[model samples]
Structure formats: C-alpha cells, structure tokens
Target: MFEWMAWTTPVVVFFTCIVLMLIAMTVWEIRSPTVMRKGLLPIATTRGDRLFIGLLTAAYINLLFVALGEKMMAWFGLEQEPSVWISFALSMLLLSIIMKKG
Candidate 1:
C-alpha cells in the first residue's frame, strides 16, 4: 500500500517524465516537418519517396536524442556513461553517411 508507493513513486515519475518529454519532442518535430526534408527533393518524385523520407526522419530524430542526451548529462554534471557516448557517435556517423547519397 503506502509502503509500496514510497519506492514505486520515483520510478513512475521518471517514466512519466520521459513520456512527457517524448510527446513534446513529437509535437516539435511535427511543427517543423520540412527541415528534415532537405536533400529529398530529387527523390520526392519516386514511388519510394515516402518510405525513404520516413526512414530519414527517424534517423534524424534518433541522432538528435543521442546528441542532446550527451549534452544534457554533461551539463548536469552526471557521470560520463560510455554507452551514451557510443550511441551518440554511432548515431551521428550513421546519419552523416545515410544522408550523403541523397
């Protein structure tokens, strides 16, 4: 009852915060759906354009999350986590290469 809530409350709050942040990000991206559309004009006329566009959008969003998370951790003086940095670098590299041939 009350004893269980004492420990679970923090976990629930953490997840709730994450969900809220994700929702905010979604709204922000939807508001500016055109920025990530760059370099896709040539492929826009193709039948697979929509699919490609969606993939690129997903990549861009993931990259942003990784990059932003790293910055946030550093800004808050949190412990430097290797996995987070690795994910950030990997995301950036993949995004760079994927967006090249477009």
Candidate 2:
C-alpha cells in the first residue's frame, strides 16, 4: 500500500518518532491535563501546542539542510554534502529544546 513513497530508514524513523510522541502526549494528557503557560515563546502554550510548533520547526530545519546541502559542502570543502543524518540529529535536538522551553 505504501510502495509509492520512498520509505527510507530516516523517513520511517522520523514519522515513527512523531507517532510515538503523539501517543505519549495523549496518554499523558488523559492522566494529567496540561495548563497553558508562558515560556521562551511569547505566547502561553500547552504541551500539545509546544509539540506542534517544535515539529514544524524541525521539518523546516530538515528542509533547509536538504536545500543547502551542496552549498554547505562547497563552503566547508567537505568530501561530500552533509549527511541527512546530521540534520536529523540537529533537528531533533532543536525540537527537544522547543518542547522544554518554548
């Protein structure tokens, strides 16, 4: 059913993480509801809100890495364009930070 999509390992991992996070958040919300609060972000936000923003930011970061990979390699004089794995790691880290402090 999914053969039309590439289904690469990174793609699978990224979507899996997102699905797991959504499930976890749903369970946590049922157990203890989140209250909106202000953090580093200008507006108050609930856990789900933070997660949504973080996910969007992570997606953009990955897109930027893909779009700029060649230019980045040229500037750094690397043997090859930066690996998508590097962007994945960085984007995940950024998501973590947003979830923690957004």
Index of the highest-TM-score prediction: 2
Clashes of each: 0, 0
Residue 72 of model 1 has an lDDT of 67
Name the regions of candidate 2 deviating beyond 4 angstroms: 1-14
9-91: candidate 2 lDDT, tens digit per residue: 97898689879988999999999999998999989999999998988998899999999999998999999999999998999
TM-score of 2: 0.84
Q: All candidates' TM-scores?
A: 0.28, 0.84
Lowest summed lDDT over 10 consecutive residues: which window, candidate 2?
A: 6-15
Model 1 TM-score, all chains together: 0.28
Q: Rate the local accuracy (lDDT) of all candidates.
A: 0.56, 0.92
- Model 2, global lDDT: 0.92
- Give candidate 1 regions above 4 Å deviation: 1-7, 34-102
